[model samples]
Target: MAQPTAATTTSDGYAEGRTDTETVSRTLATSESGLEVTVFDSIRSISAARWNEVVERSTCGSVFHRYEWLEAIEAGLGKTPRHLVVEKDGNLIGLLPNFVVDIEKTPFRRLSSSYPGFGGPLVTTDVAESLSLLAEAVPELCTGRTVVHQIRGLDTKYMRYNNYLQSEGYEPYRRECRFVLDLTQGYGEIYDGMSKTRRRGIDRGTDGDYEIVEEELTRPNLERFHRVYEQVMDRVDGDGYPLSFFERLLDMRERLLLLTIRIDGEYAGGFLELLDEQRSSIHGFFAAVPEDYFGDHASELLYDYVIRWGIDNGYDTYDFGSTNANFENGVFRFKEGFGGRILPILVWERGCSPLWKMLKAGRSLYWPHRYE
Candidate 1:
């Protein structure tokens, strides 16, 4: 079993209390069994090769867990990272990509996973022990500073890890659903396997005058998509990231797929999906279209194009993003039509300080509509 040494502070100024000497000594220590865990203030400080190696070996790993993704978040969102790397016998074995959220004057100081997707620890088959050690180290890392420790992921694939967290006093909250389409069976079979209604929708969308064009991740193209995205968010009363977020994503063009739906050469709808070539999966991250185009099935055409692109590119699955399990709304219905299976995604959270209780009580008073 891996054992943790003394808790270390991050080199970045984000580590509020601890001094540099304390942090450096803690980082260099090892357990009796030669297991060591180090916390990094920035993803750039860690070896890309070593970090990605653990990601490649973990079953639940995704593009969101990649070093570049987290680096982008740091560069774009300005979130302070507290990335944990675990090693045994001098070999990297486990990783947890987390960030600290400490807004000025707000009583809430949270250490959480990256937004919009699965993020917890990605470990080897010896999941129980690796997670237990990491969990044990969390409290010390926070050191009475953070109010809450929150971990969110897209599926229950980490059932064992979740159970371990529960035993450690974490409350499992917000059960969401994710739709995934299996692409290993070949595109023809998968398309035929879809519900009759979905097939008809696709047929209509294909016959429509709209044309699907795969666009390069240019600033202008991203800006066009952002306009549609803003409109979609407005219609649904949803909050969105700044335009800079999409721009940062566009900067990492090699790892993305930007497909636009056009009606008579004018942009109508589109999706910005992430490509995980190593995992043979494509994640449908964000999509947008005018509310008037809902009936026109512009999204249907976009999805069809994305699925075909995945199949042609030899990907194994298409993740249609996440939805609330309690709400079977238009978004849920649209993704369900693809004949994808709905899986439960669990978010585990625990209040570590008294401020957390206060924050929960005054949640509406503080930020009423902000989706955490």
Candidate 2:
């Protein structure tokens, strides 16, 4: 049964997706483990304190798994939040944040822990047992709600998830790569590591013709950013993040930074950075500059500026985000120029309908970058 979800706030100032105080609890899996699994239809029913405690404690915990991000996802993307939590002896043990994504005009429906972000089940302790219960509770509790119930952003080093995934007959589907720049090294070394062309481009930004503007989230600033952003999306033949998405993102202003590059006091281009303290990383997200501004190497300068800022702020890594495995992709080549370690984009999936997976697989050959 589906529970009604209304936008509300928790006592701690986190966004809430439900008004009800009660949870749809179920005692699932082996009773021998003494762990109780409870499935939540709302983020409000679960205490933010307890939820964040597990997130902070788990090695796999990321900002995406944190309570606030889920709040933003619900508001920004308008996806209904779902969570599967586990407790043993009345103590919190595990959490998996999920949302229902139904593609408009299509039969595709999924229960994604996070649809477009990185998140997986997190446990405070007793990792093996907690993960077992969390994984097992999904199929029984989530059956028929969606065609697939999958988790994203599981690390390759954590074989426990892989072990359970195989045990439960879940399939590994998406294999992509993310670029991570090592920030432990000195600034000079980091700069030197970049391709010669990129280094020269960054230096060009210092030609006294460009300025980096850090502005407040006012209407004008946002409109200008979106203007450039829309053109960039059109240029790449990609869909731009809706204006409402960014509007809903205002809830995350404390952890978000919007920087635009100015060439002779004109808005040339900029990018938004998600300051992720949980991972000790700065992620390069939502960036754009006009083609006219390309000559000034504004894009390269944006990367250089953000990377320097991350280094000075003590962030351990700078992520260029993910791209396709294909070398021919221009985005991939652009990120490779900055000298970052390439790592696989791990996404775990379990589809209830083989027909859907089959059709998706066939479609994927034509659109390798898409997910069903």
Candidate 3:
């Protein structure tokens, strides 16, 4: 993707000479709380120290907010996502990581950062102003003739795009709630915090009949994990499939960990997690169980072990990623059972002339359900 034309400060504020081709550009703007917005071709443009400092100041931010994870996503996933930084004169205030997602080979397109997961801008209390700047800037930067600005896994309260959608007749979007296990008090305190029944289940799995094993996906395990992943996907009636390339993605990135529940030597269920320095985030990646084991709570076994392992290893947070159901669904309920707190995700999107019309024409394709 081409970079935006040089930004020139002018009486009108800042005049970014329009680009001849389509692209997303980072610009410097003096905005709310005396902050300036800086755009990047990729998340790697910012140093890890600067990126993480902003995360530490934000409420829902975690170690997964580090630049290395963003770099891993970009390296493993073939998408060129851009990262935008909002600075206060010189100090960092906020971040908006976005990408230009093409529809395979079609003329269709959209802008996203971290897809299939709830990762948007991490900011202090300046959400409204930070989002407003993005709302106005997205349309101008898009290069696609018709692009759907897909703001993924958004927490509605802090977002600005919902207003635009309301006027545009897009209706309210879906809600997803994540399960987070808090580790402030120590693992023992956290373990005792669980309900007696859940505690028993974890203890029961320890009888050796159900072995909760933490294994990095070796070459053979990767192949086995893929087989189980495919079965789970098929059972869920899913399409727009996760490419086999993702197995390679996990291998290439080497940041992925596969936590599995083995029932007397059989692969009953599993969960995938992405680890950085201080946090292990559970990507709602994939899990599979035999029909007979559904009643046995193999899924719960997987969750419990992953959470326990994460806490024991001195990690600060065990993120349950996001779910399409906010107040409902077994996914959310099970995670909540572990005493997880809630955090809202937000997305801010704006469309350009050509892309807006195209999105309307191909609305179905532009807004298909995303299975990440």
What would the TM-scores of all predictions be? 0.82, 0.85, 0.62
Candidate 1 structure quality by residue, lDDT tens digits, 79-113:
77788877887788989888887734674567887
Steric clash count of candidate 3:
12
Instruction: Write down the worst ten-residue block by lDDT for model 3.
Output: 11-20
Off by over 4 Å in 2: 1-30, 102-106, 141-145, 154-160, 217-224, 368-372
Q: lDDT per model, in order? A: 0.75, 0.75, 0.60
Tens-digit lDDT track of model 3 for 228-283? 77787777765423444455445334556677777877778676676644333444
Ranking by TM-score: 2, 1, 3
Better of 1 and 3 by lDDT: 1
Model 3, residue 47: what's the lDDT? 66
> Cα lDDT for residue 203, model 1?
86
